[model samples]
Target: MLILGIETSCDETAAAVVADGRTILSEVTLSQDLHNLYGGVVPELASREHTRTLVPVVREAISEAEISYDDLEGIAVTNGPGLVGALLVGLSFAKALSYSLNKPLVGINHLEAHIFSVLLERPELVPPFLCLIISGGHSNLYLVESLGRYRSIGSTRDDAAGEAFDKVAKLLGLGYPGGPAIDEVAKSGNRDFIKFPKARMKSGGYDFSFSGLKTAVAIYVSKLNEKELQKRRADIAASFQEAVVGALLDNTIAAAEEHRMARIAVCGGVASNSRLRERLKASSETQGLLVFYPSLELCTDNAAMVAAAGNFRLENFPPDDLELDAFPYLELGD
Candidate 1:
């Protein structure tokens, strides 16, 4: 099926065309640089930006695919777990488009879309595998048995892994989008510079907690003078990155082992972290497990992933009856 995907759950306004979930016909994403000035997203600005760019973005994707609206078999969109206004922009556009085009409408869960991001590249990836979804708004561990079937085995207790990265980056005076900033700065520094805490669940479960680790970073940076902070900035980035990566790798590896699964896929914005990609690859290799991650573009919010996920949903689940609405707090597999 040829699916037109729209994604505006966050600051980015994206649209794409995918064929049968595995083939990307065409895709376009316009990122809102406006958010950078505020060091975080402004929901109002995000929705306004989406409203403005939604038409052009989707038009460009269809034009790039060399297909008119008549060629599309279905329309897919992200409708949940994001700012209500931002999500509404895309959902409204998608629903209207679907109705006018007489195409099937599929509503996608944002987090579930992240998990399916890898499927676009690795079509062979199927059920009976573990997936670690680490992003700005989410840090979850799931046992993906099949399309639309998710068993959440582990998740965050407080701030997500990417959220901690952003918070720590702010503390270090790193600009917006902390994951990339920390990844770049930590390259030349020592990962063992500070023995930052990597919390392990006392119950021996897969659940995670980054609040303490974030507080520790805050307290450590607070003690440093201006000159000291400038001198150790790279070290701080490296050490903090190490702590976060450690917790992620340990939990994922443990989960894979406990589940007796040899294949794993890590997706979402945080999966783009150099440290995370490197460590997960290295650890998976050492433990004789296969790990998959989407490319940098797909790791961030994109309509391609949404379309890719929606293709599966369209095949498995029935299309919505137009009564569907944007759900700002939708859970995966809901």
Candidate 2:
């Protein structure tokens, strides 16, 4: 089945054509540089950028795939759990295309697409596994039993991991998309320079809380002299990154053990961190759990994952009518 996926949930305006979920015929992503200048994403700017770039980007994807609109069996778009204005651009375009082409339209949850990203790489991968989804806007663990099925095992009580990273990086004068910036500097630094507190919930559940850790970094950096701060940038980066990675890995492994699940997967933008990947792999091995992740490029927002998810939903669920609209806060299990 040929599916065209549109994603504009955040700062990226992306479109892709996926065949049978595994094969990505074409993918085009238009990133918003304006957000970087502002130190974070501005919703109004994101929506305007999406409106301007969505059509051309989608056209490029279709052309690159060497396919026409007539060849598509369905259209899939991220419907919610993101900026409502940003999401509307893709949703509106997708609905119009689906209605005009008389193809099935599936509303995909952004978080679900991240989980399905694993299936793109491992076609034989099944559910009943523990999943760690850490992104800019969210950090949650789930027991996934099948497509569109999820049980929330735990989630962040405060700041999401990615949000914490960005905030820490900003405080340190690092650039936007803090994950990469921190990861880059952390390569030469020591992970033990500044001891940051890891928040272990008192409830003894798998839930996470990075807000305290972020605050610790902020406080530590504030006390540093200009000379001391500049001299130990790498060490500070490494230490902060270690804390973030440790928190995620610890909770994820705990979830796997609690659920008695042998398969483990990490998804979303933070999943692209090399440190996180290495720790997850090592921890998974020690725990005797199989670990899965999307290729680095697919780790962030992309259309291929969206289309892959759409294909799964289209194959399993009945078609929806033109009344389907963008859902700003659709839950995963809903």
lDDT of each: 0.90, 0.89
Worst 10 residues of 1 by lDDT: 325-334
Tens digits of lDDT, candidate 2, 1-334 = 8999999999999999999988999989888989998788999999999999998999999999999999999999999889999998899899989998999999999989999888888877798888888999889898998767898888889988999989988988888989899999999999988888999899998889999998888899899998988888889989999999998888888778878999988889999999988887787777788988888888888999999999998999986677777777677762
Error of model 2, residue 30, in angstroms: 1.2
TM-scores for every candidate against the unseen true structure: 0.97, 0.97
CA error at residue 156 for candidate 2, angstroms: 1.5
lDDT of 1: 0.90
Query: For model 1, how does the per-residue alpha-carbon lDDT over 273-299 read when each residue is reduced to its tens digit?
Result: 988888887887789999888888899
Clash number for candidate 1: 0
